[model samples]
Target: MAYVITSSCIGKKVGECAQVCPVDCIQEGEEMFFIDPDVCIDCGACEAVCPEAAIYPEEEVPEDEKRFIQLNRDFFHRD
Candidate 1:
């Protein structure tokens, strides 16, 4: 699964994660950054560089913060 950026990133926009992403899947949104699951390679490069520790693998996303999984996906709606 791909990674998800949680609420910890909201209003922070610490963009180091996007800088290290090999596939350029991380993108800036109005309130935070989102990882485009369709484009992410699950390489964890972004996760390692995230200063706020806001990124997590889909399966490992904390239960309370799991909504960000869908939030991240919905940002890149393909329709």
Candidate 2:
């Protein structure tokens, strides 16, 4: 499964995740960075480097933070 970036990253787009992402699926939004689910390789590389600890596996995302899974998708699919 793809990884999701949670609210902890909303205002602190440190972007460490982006640097380590081998597939470069992370993209900076206005307030944070989002993972392009379709492109993520599930390598967990970005999650390991996130300074805010904001990244989680799709199925493992916290209950309250689960919305981020869709938000990550929305960020890439926005029209």
Which candidate number would show the highest lDDT if scored against the true structure? 2
Candidate 2 vs. true structure, TM-score: 0.96
Q: Each candidate: what lDDT?
A: 0.93, 0.94
After superposition, candidate 1 runs with Cα above 4 Å error: none
Give candidates' CA RMSD values in order: 1.0, 0.6
Candidate 1 on 1-79: residue-level lDDT in tens?
A: 8999999999999899999998999999999999999999999998898889999999999999988989889999957
State candidate 1's TM-score.
0.95
Instruction: Tell me the tens digit of each residue's lDDT in model 2 across 1-79.
Output: 8999999999999988999999999999999999999999999998888889999999999999988999999999989
Q: Please identify model 2 stretches exceeding 4 Å from their true place.
A: none
Q: Candidate 2's C-alpha lDDT?
A: 0.94
> Where does candidate 2 have its weakest 10-residue lDDT segment?
44-53
Taking the candidates one at a time, how many backbone clashes does each contain? 0, 0
Compute the lDDT of residue 5 as modeled in candidate 2: 96
